[model samples]
Target: MILTAPVSMFAMLMTYSSNGSSSRPWVTPLVLFSLPLLFASLALRRAIPALKRSPQGSGDRSAAAVALCLGGLVYALALGPALDNVGVL
Candidate 1:
């Protein structure tokens, strides 16, 4: 999870930074997407024992991670359109 989070963050940052001379509409979505994963990761780290003890906890965490990834993709898609209209892309 740690590895995945950093990679995902890096990808988002790269995408954000790569948009030259304009803002990406999807930036909000990307930020929104990353915020949850960041919080979840922190929560999981702080509650490692609880997560380990719960039989279904791992699945829950995986689901949350997947959701975050989907959010990022959605953001990426929306970003272009958003930027096109707002003159930021």
Candidate 2:
């Protein structure tokens, strides 16, 4: 989970083509990839007593936080507006 976040982030970053015609934006990919890490980290924390307060969960927690924030921004600025326009919000 921790590893996937970076890979996904890099993958998304690479899409920002010089011609401004990237296949996908970084925000969506970052959030989508980070969510699973977050869940896995939480689950690991619960499953292992020491992981709750140890560094083991740090990566996942941080990634999750980042993803959530970016995802929220994207939803609010892009998805939400589009949905609202169609009366789906």
Candidate 3:
């Protein structure tokens, strides 16, 4: 999950940079990608205890998923200036 977040953020940044002719085109994709992560994170938070009780690798999986979602959000906000500089709305 952590890996995917950075990749998604990078993809968003690239999308913003490459689509210079459009205004705010990045918003749709950003929201689209983010919404799922947001909901997944909420669900994870709710399921943590149940997940912790699960055998094997469930706990690690949950942690990684949470990390990825958070990292993606952080990257999106952190990379905003680059996006705007590249012509994002």
Ten residues in sequence with the least summed lDDT for candidate 3: 19-28
| Model 1 segments more than 4 A misplaced | 1-57
Q: Residue by residue across 9-84, what tens digits does model 2's lDDT show?
A: 6665676666765544545445554655456556444545533444645775565556556545544555553455
Candidate 3 residue runs with Cα over 4 Å from true position: 1-57
- The best-first sequence of candidates by TM-score reads 1, 3, 2
Q: Assess each prediction's global lDDT (C-alpha) against the native.
A: 0.54, 0.54, 0.58
Residue pairs with colliding backbones in model 3 are: none
Deviating ranges (above 4 Å) for candidate 2: 1-57, 87-89
lDDT value for model 2: 0.54
| Highest-scoring model, TM-score | 1
Model 3, range 8-89, lDDT digits (tens) per residue?
Answer: 6666575565545545455534544564556655665655665556566766666756765665675666467447656664
Model 1 CA lDDT for position 86: 73
Top-down lDDT ranking: 3, 1, 2
* Model 2 residue-pair collision total: 0
Worst 10 residues of 1 by lDDT: 19-28
Can you give the lDDT of residue 50 in candidate 3?
A: 54
Root-mean-square deviation of every model: 10.8, 10.0, 8.2
Q: Estimated TM-score per prediction?
A: 0.35, 0.29, 0.33
